[model samples]
Target: MQVVTTIAGSDSGGGAGIQADLKTFQELKVFGTSVITALTAQNTLGVSGVMPIEASFVEQQLQALLEDFSISAVKTGMLFSSAIIQTVAQMTANTKVPLIVDPVMIAKGGESLLRQDAIDAIINHLLPVATIVTPNIPEAETLTGKEINTLADIKEVAKLLLQTGVQCVIIKGGHLADRNFAIDYIFFKNGQSFSMQTPRIASKNTHGTGCTFSAAITAFLGSGLPIKEAIIEAKKFIQLAITYDLALGNGHGPTNHFAYQNYKETCEVIIHES
Candidate 1:
C-alpha cells in the first residue's frame, strides 16, 4: 500500500485538520500517517483554543516517519507558527516525494489557523518545494495581496503563485459571492490550466472540505495518478462527500468521507439491476 503523510494540526472536532486528512486518505485506499503540528479545541460551532506543538517535536516526528516509512506523498495543513513552517520546509527540502501544500489559514468558524507572520515563511520557503499548492479564495488573496472578484483575477493570482516556484496552483472558488456553483481553477506551471464546477451544496456540514479535498489529491498522487487526473478525482470525491454529509454536529458538521464508497456501491447496484 502507498503511504501518505499529513503534517497538520489535530482537530478535536474530528471534522478538519489531521483527523479529516487521515479519514480522506483511508477512504481513498491509502495508508495514512500524521505529524501533528498543533491541536485545536474546536467543534462544529467554533474554535475555542489552539496549542502549537514545539517545533523540535514536530521535526522529530517527521524524522521518525521519514526513517521508518517510505512516504510516497505528503500534504500539509494548518501549520500554526513560523517556526513549525520553517521546520517542515527544511525537513522536506531534500525528499523527492510529492508535497501537497494546503494553505489552511482560517477555520470554518472564522478562526485564524495560520499565524499572520507565518504566511511569508510559507510563501518563501514552503511553496517553492510544493508539487501543488491548494488555497481557497481568501487564502489566495492573502498570499498574493490581491482582491479576487472574477475568474480573470483568480488566473492572475495563480500566475503570481506560480512565480513563487510551485509546480501547480489550485485556487478554490468556494467563497465567491452569489454563485450557484463552486468553481475551482487549476493552473500548471507550464502554462496549462482548467476549471471545475460543481453545484454548490446548501449545507453547513462543510467543515473539512478543503482538507479532505487536498488529502484526496495527495492519496491519488501517492497512487501514481497524474496531477490533473488527481485533481479531478479529488474534486469528485469531495462533491460526493459533501452531497451526503452526515449532519452530525450542531454547527458546521463534517463531510462524510465514506460517502464515495456508498456512492460506488449504489452505482454498482443500479448497473447490475439495469
Candidate 2:
C-alpha cells in the first residue's frame, strides 16, 4: 500500500481534523501516517481546549516520517499559529512532494482553528508550495479579498488564489447562491476548470466532508493518480459519505464514511474526466 501523511491537529471527536483524514485514507486503502500539530479536547459538542505540540516536536515528527515513510503525498489541516505554519512550510519546502493544503479556519460549530495572523503566513509560505489549496467560502474570501456571491465570484476567487502560486484551487460553493445543489469549482492554474455539482443532502451529518475530501485527494495522489482524477474520485466519495450518514452529535454529525458500499451504482466513480 502507498504511504500518505497528514500534518494536522487531532480531534477527539473522531469527525473532522486528523481523525477524519486518517479514516478517509484507510477507507481508500492507503497506509496512513500522521504528525499532530495540536491535541484538542473536542467532541461533537465543541472544542473545549487546544494544546499545541511544540514546534520542535512537530519538526521531529515530520522529519522522522519523511526520513522513513517515503510519503507519496501530504495533507494539512489545523495549524493554530503563524509559527506552526512556517515550521510546516519549511519542513515541506525541500521535499518537493505533492501537498494538499486545507485552509481550515473555522470549525463547523463556529470555533477558530486558525489564528488571523496565521493567514498571511499561509498565503506567503504554504500556498505557493501547495499542489492544491482547498478553501471554503470564508477562507476563500480571506485569501482573495473578494465577496463570493455567484459562479463568477467563485471563478475569480480561483484566479486570485492561483496567482499566489498554488497549482490548483477548489473554491467550495456550499455558501453560494445555490441552496439545494452543492457546487464546487476546481480551477487549474492554467485556466482549465472542472465543476462538480451534487444534490445537497439536507442533514447535519456533514461534519468532516472537507477533511475527508482533501484526505481522499492525498490518498489518490499517493497512489499516483492524476490531479483531476484524484479530485473527481474524492468528490464521489464525499457525496456517498453525505448521503446515508447518521446524525450522531447534537452538532453536525459525522459523515457515514462507509456509505459507498451500499449505493455502488450511484457511488460508482469515473476518475478520469467524463
Candidate 3:
C-alpha cells in the first residue's frame, strides 16, 4: 500500500487535526503515518487548551519515520509554534515527496491553533517546499495581508501565494459571503486556474473540513494521481464528507470521513462558474 504521513496536532475531540487526517487517509486506502506537533484538549463545544510538543521530539519522530517508510506524500496541519514549523520544514525540505500544507490557523470555535509568530516561518520555510498549500479565506487574508471579498480578490491572493514558491494554491470559499453554494478556487503557478462549486449544505457538522480536504488530496497524490486529478478527487471526497454528516457532536461536528469510501460510485464532481 502507498504510505502517507501527516505532521499535525492531535485533537482529543477526534473531529480534526491528526484524527481527521488519519481517518481521511484510511478511507482513501493509503497507509497512514503521523508526527504529532501538539495535543489539544477540545470537544465539539470548543478548544480549552493546547500543549505543543517539543521541536526536538517532533524532529525525532520525523527522523525515525524517514529512516523506515517510503512516504509517498506528506501533509502538515497545525504546527502551533515557529520552532515546530521550522523543525518540520527542515525535515521535509530536501525530500522529493509531495507536500500538502494546510494553513490551519484557527478552530471552528475561534480558538487559535497557530501562533502569531509562526506565520513568517510557514511562508518563508514551509511554503517554499510545499507542492500545494490549502488556505481558507481568512488564512489567505492572513497570509497575504489583504482583504478577500470577491472572486477577483481570491485570484489576486492566489497569485501572491504562488510567489511563495508553492506549486499551487487552493483558496477555499466557505467563508465568502455567498450562502448558496460553496466555491473553491484552485490556481497553479503555471497560470492555470479553475473553480469548483457545490450547493452549500446547511449543516453545523463541518468542523474538520479543511483538514479532511487536504488529507484527501494527500491520499490521492500518494496513490499516484496527478496534482489536478488529486485535487478533483479530493473535492469529491470532501463534498461527500460534508453532505453525509455524522451528527456526533453538540457544536461543530466532523464530516463523515468514511462517506467518500462508502459512496464513491455515486459521488459526482460539480465544476461551475461562481
Model 3 scores worst on lDDT over the 10 consecutive residues at 265-274
Candidate 3 residue spans exceeding 4 A from truth: 272-274
Tens-digit per-residue lDDT, 1-274, candidate 2: 8999999999999998899998988888899999999998887778899898887899999999988978899999998889889999988877888999999988888889888899999999999889999999998998778988777788778888898899999887677766778877889987788778888778878887888889989999999999988888888888898888877878888987777556646764322221
Q: Which stretches of candidate 1 lie above 4 Å from their native place?
A: 264-274
Q: How much does each candidate deviate from the true structure in C-alpha RMSD?
A: 4.4, 2.0, 1.2
Better of 1 and 3 by lDDT: 3
State each model's CA lDDT, in order.
0.91, 0.86, 0.93
Best by TM-score: 3
Clash number for every model? 0, 0, 0
Per-residue lDDT, model 1, residue 169, is: 96
Worst 10 residues of 1 by lDDT: 265-274
TM-score of each: 0.95, 0.95, 0.98
Using lDDT as the measure, the top candidate is 3
